[model samples]
Target: MTSAGSTGWNVVQLADIPATPWRNGGGVTRELAMWPDAGDWAWRMSVADVDKSGPFSKFDGIDRWFTVLEGAGVQLDVAGVLHRVTAGDAPLFFDGAADTGCELIDGKTRDFNLMVRRGSQPSKMVRVEGRHSETLNAMKTIAVYAHHSPARVLFDEEVLQLAHATLAWRMVTGSAAVGIAAQGALWMEIPA
Candidate 1:
């Protein structure tokens, strides 16, 4: 099952959110992702600030997402059930094997995360600002994350480009129709 725009995704840069002591009590910087399909089915990205504290552990074939890039509260706790997230809303799923924690409220914050596994399938995160079109199947893969200014993805003719926080392509087959010539902000993934 690999027709209608056959697979493509590139634009990953991470590894810069480390100092310890809760990121020196302020100014937390992150990226540390870009697995590029290798081994234990991995994919990770990070960005966090504002009263930062963390307790993230659990990966039995991962599957998770938490997005809040800016400010307006943030709180997450899986296995105990507690979620209060803001900043563009909608993208809070759990069960990455359970047991996770985080709590933040006030100013200074940025967030984006994706952990994929569970037998190399089942993955979805959405937040696209402009032009759109969809349809992909076959081992599945689609990931596009950019926020305003710098966009262009047309699967079925082959064209992958992105800017403004670039988290470009990742498609694994057939049916295309995703356009964004202006208004940015995006995140798309399919892996079931």
Candidate 2:
């Protein structure tokens, strides 16, 4: 876990996260963050590499959001309904307990994922390209992920730089305007 300080915000380097093989042996996943750290989590963020077609792990009571970050993409069969998703596309949200399977559309792919326990406040993830900014809406925590391109995040008077494929996160209160400079990035807001 890479970090800038013990403050409310810090950067997480992708290279610092060890990759673990998926339960189904399809590929590996690098967990970025998990709430409560040592016990059952209310939310989690991760990046996964999909190299083969297989069924996704079922989380029973979790809500999942996914976005492709690299390579081509994958076709997801959620409860028998097929959906094709590609890099740079908006995130896809689904029930973690659903019967879901994946098929490689074109070779290997990298994806970003957020999982929130059921009954928790809803969260949002959006793909950002070039220079952009947004106001956090009563979110208790926020994460900004730089995908292929480097990014700079400005919150209040603090400025944080994120190298390619890395991410920065902070526990927030109330609302704030966040300035972002990136060629490509993903912003996620989790409610308190």
Candidate 3:
């Protein structure tokens, strides 16, 4: 991850982030960003490359947003309810405290995840295609991730070119307009 000058912005390239193997030996995760940058972070973002089906780690009192990024997709069982999620499909929001398990549809899959502790702050994540433009909220943190393709972001008089699987996050205070041009991506709004 690299800082974007002194704008309170950080740019994360998935290829540059190292992966950490899972204890279950089913997957490896690359953490994209985390608040506090230390112990007991309030929120964290990551991408997981799953090679097999397995149970997910339970994070009590946390809310989660999940999306399939690549591969054949997955069959997820969340609290006894089965949900089939594929790439380009709508995102799934579930309680992180639930007994959740992921079963790959075919062989391998990559997924994006956002976890935030309960009561810390509310967050919103959504899939973005085509062009998206919105006014920023001064009280909230904002991030735009380019998934599988290159994307462009316009803020003030600046333009940020985001490569595939890249995330551009702004953590500083203040509000400004942001215009994102992405083929397929994720837009996140969280606590600053």
Candidate 4:
């Protein structure tokens, strides 16, 4: 249900954005926050708020994708499914409609969170570590983080340079591209 185009791609550094408090139904807290745009559905980078203890309450009406950014491991209690996630694994997607909470399995954990419209906009948070081609339809926004070498980001026929940390790109509907880099992570946001 989005009509945005592919010309919105722009790169940004993750460290450049200030961390903000994570707000949910009961106003939960997180460590960091970043996104391509502060639109209705916001993609985020969140480190755990270990300082705060939580068997915290859950939330609804949002779609969430969780990807590990650092630390040992993390697990989520969704509805009744206990999903244990580690680094370098595929991201976990669940409905925010469930009564979900998090527990740090070992040490603290850092992760990326994508909150989008339940049905109007469906999205995925992928951890891109090598060369791959992504065919993205609908309105798409990509956030790439360079963990090792500088990242080469391609959008349609254009290319942009990205440094270690985090960067974002906006692509129009029906556009796709391939990315090449030594090491890093890429999260693509799409309509649900």
Report the C-alpha lDDT of model 1 over 1-192, residue by residue, as the tens digit.
Answer: 111233445565323235233534544545444455335445665554545656765678577787786677678788888898876677887778898777776655677777766554567786666676665545556666665467777767667765566665554655555555536565657564
Sort by lDDT, best first.
Answer: 2, 3, 1, 4
Clashing pairs in 2: none
TM-score of 3: 0.93
Number of the top TM-score candidate:
2
In model 2, the worst 10-residue window by lDDT is 2-11
Worst 10 residues of 4 by lDDT: 25-34
Residue pair clashes in candidate 4 = 5-172, 6-171, 6-172, 9-170, 121-191, 121-192, 122-191, 122-192
Count of steric clashes across candidates, in order: 12, 0, 0, 8
Per-candidate Cα lDDT values, in order, are 0.62, 0.87, 0.87, 0.59
Residue 186 shift from truth in candidate 2, angstroms: 0.3
* Lowest lDDT 10-residue stretch of candidate 1: 1-10
**Mind giving the per-residue lDDT tens digits that candidate 3 earns over 122-159?**
78888888988878756777888899678898887688
Query: By the lDDT metric, which is better: model 1 or model 2?
Result: 2
Off by over 4 Å in 4: 1-7, 21-53, 147-149
TM-score of every candidate relative to the true structure: 0.32, 0.94, 0.93, 0.74
lDDT, residue 160, model 2: 82
